[model samples]
Target: MHIKTRLTILNFLEFFSWGAWLLSAGAYMSTTLGFTGVQIGSVYATLGIASIFMPPVIGIIADRWIPAEKLFGISHLLLAGLFVVLTSMTSFNSFYMVTFLVALVYMPTLALSNSISYYNLEKEGLDSVVTFPPIRVWGTVGFIIAAWLVDVLGLKVSHEQFYLAAAASVLLGGYSFSLPLIPIVKNTSRTLFQRFGLDAFVLFKNKNLAIFLVFSVLLGAALQITNIWGVPFLNDFSISYKDSFVVKHAVFLMSLSQVSEVLFILAIPFFLKRFGIKIVVLISMFAWVFRFGFFGVGSPEGMGLLFLITSMIIYGMAFDFYVISGSLYVDKMSDAKVRSSAQGLFMMMVNGFGAVLGAYISGFVVDYYTANNGIKDWASIWFICAVYALIIGVLFALVFRYKHTGEENLVIKK
Candidate 1:
């Protein structure tokens, strides 16, 4: 295979593993395990919890000890084993434990994939700005493929999805070994017992960065709310409207969000350059408001379809701007020695601490609003999320001031 083709396949398999379960797991919990909102939150929180320490630590090891490619391979191989175990789990505690273990192996792959891609791109003499987005977009396509497979193959909310995910992960794990070796270099000149990628901690010292990280945690809370509840929400509509198309194809329908993510990502350079990162991100924040609020008010019926479409469209901004743009912003500002660590730090806030906190709390809120018979109060749940996102958006606008530089300005309009 051509190097780009090899890398593209790598991207596809990497996200396909996630696509198998991430979006559809809500329905599995709600319909299969009969878990409450808090229970769901706890499960999703495992991703956040693992992300907090795992990514940076593993990154440090990759930088200083083992080849990153080897570590990446090992992580996915571990996840493949865990996914098999997860398929056998029938209880919440057992399942949560297994999922947590799976997360420790899986979540960091997100960061690792980027690291690998960045290294490869630079090696090939391609600008990440121009090349990475196209490659990264395939990951979303992989996600869509996974969702379709689960839906069409009738694996929704079943162990089969995990089996499929396991197979892909194993394939990717072995394939990782074929890529270029990422060497680990020891730094004998360093001090004792400092945290892995600790330079990210200094971001706390910058006022704007402190606020950004703070809001990142808060917004990160809003990020997973839909994933934990949306499928089940659509499924609930199935209970009353059994023949509704939404129920029949809920996972496939939700995949639209991922599909939309590609287009939104393409728009990022324009938004970033034209308006600057601050406004671009703020627009993304408000986009989250629309994302959740539409769900609160929308239905499978006529104009509700518009609302649903709007929500999906806005999701591109809500997700891409904060994550991709935020990463780039950090890159533009940080020095080379600590750049990787800084990126890991931003992820720790958004995906690690933020996601964990969101999942745990959302579970409580979602379950609390759910009635005695166990039907989720999706409207109320979405409403709460909409409000949370709105508040965060408002606060972000008030804080974190920055004027776009000339170089960044050129990048955007180009």
Candidate 2:
């Protein structure tokens, strides 16, 4: 097979492993395991908690010693076993422990997967500039497919979702071994801190990077709000919009965001090159406003449905322009030696600290509005979320300063 095809398959299965349970896990925990609201939030926060340090630590190892592909494979291999264990856990504490371990083993794979792809792509003499976006889009497709399969197959409330994800994890783990081997040539001249990737944290010493990272964490919380709450938000619509097919098939409806993701992912290079980081990021922040506002105001039926659909469309820009572009920005800002670690640190901020903050706060907002029979005043909840995004956008525009000289000039694209 072509190297692109191999990497594409790798990307697909990698996301499939997460998609099989990511969006649906809440329903299973609530309905099946009888977890409380706090328990459920904590369980999902495991991803954020693990993401905080795992990526940088493993990234340091990959950069200094072990090949990224090998580490990627081993993480997934262990993840497969852990997912299997997750299917058998009956209590909240046990499930939390196992899930945290699963997240620890799994979160770092995100950056590792990207590094492995970049390493292999460069070796093949293919331009990641042109090759990677298309290949990575399949990962979104795999995520959507998993959401559809679990929902359509009646596995959302069962342990089978974890099993399905584990099977994919097993396949991905084994397949990762076949990826191109990345070298592990450590720089012996580096100090101990540099050797362990503590050096990547130095970017925080720069004023602009410091400002960017702080805002990245704040915006990242917005991303987490949607991912953690979107499924339930839509499902709640089935109460009033009972006859609406969109509400009935909320998972598939939300998958439209992923479909939109593919398009925006392709367009990222174009927009970032044309508008530069500030404008592109502003686009994302503003898009988040609409993303949450539409959710807050729109109903599953009536003309309000238009807002929901539009929100899904905006999600592509919201996610692709912000998270994806932000990663590229981190790549541009950091030196080559700290490349992997920088990516890990970026992941740590957005997926880790940001995600934890979003999960807890959103949980509070949800509980605040929740009433008898579990019905929630979603509009008020979403309104507050939208306000938060708006605040971030305004703050980013006013406080986060940068001059655009074109992305081609950046270290990442070059």
Number of the top-ranking candidate, with TM-score as the measure? 2
Cα error of candidate 1 at position 42, Å: 0.8
Off by over 4 Å in 1: 1-3, 193-197, 409-414
Residue lDDT tens for model 2, 1-414:
988899899999999899899888887887689776667778878888988899999989888888888899988999999999999998988999999999899989888877777777878887665677788889988998998998898787789899999999999989888887788756774687765667888888777778888988898889888777787777777676777877667777777888899899899878877888889999999999999999988777777889989999999999888887887777767776777788889899988898888878877778889887777899999899999999999999998878887645455321
TM-score (C-alpha, index-matched) for candidate 1: 0.94
lDDT per residue, candidate 1, 17-105, as tens digits?
Answer: 99999988888887788777777889999989988988777767776677778888988898899999999898999989999998888
What overall lDDT goes with each candidate model?
A: 0.80, 0.84
- Clashing residue pairs in candidate 1 are 37-363, 38-363, 273-412
The TM-score values for the models, in the order shown, are 0.94, 0.95
TM-score of 2: 0.95
Backbone clashes for every candidate come to 3, 0
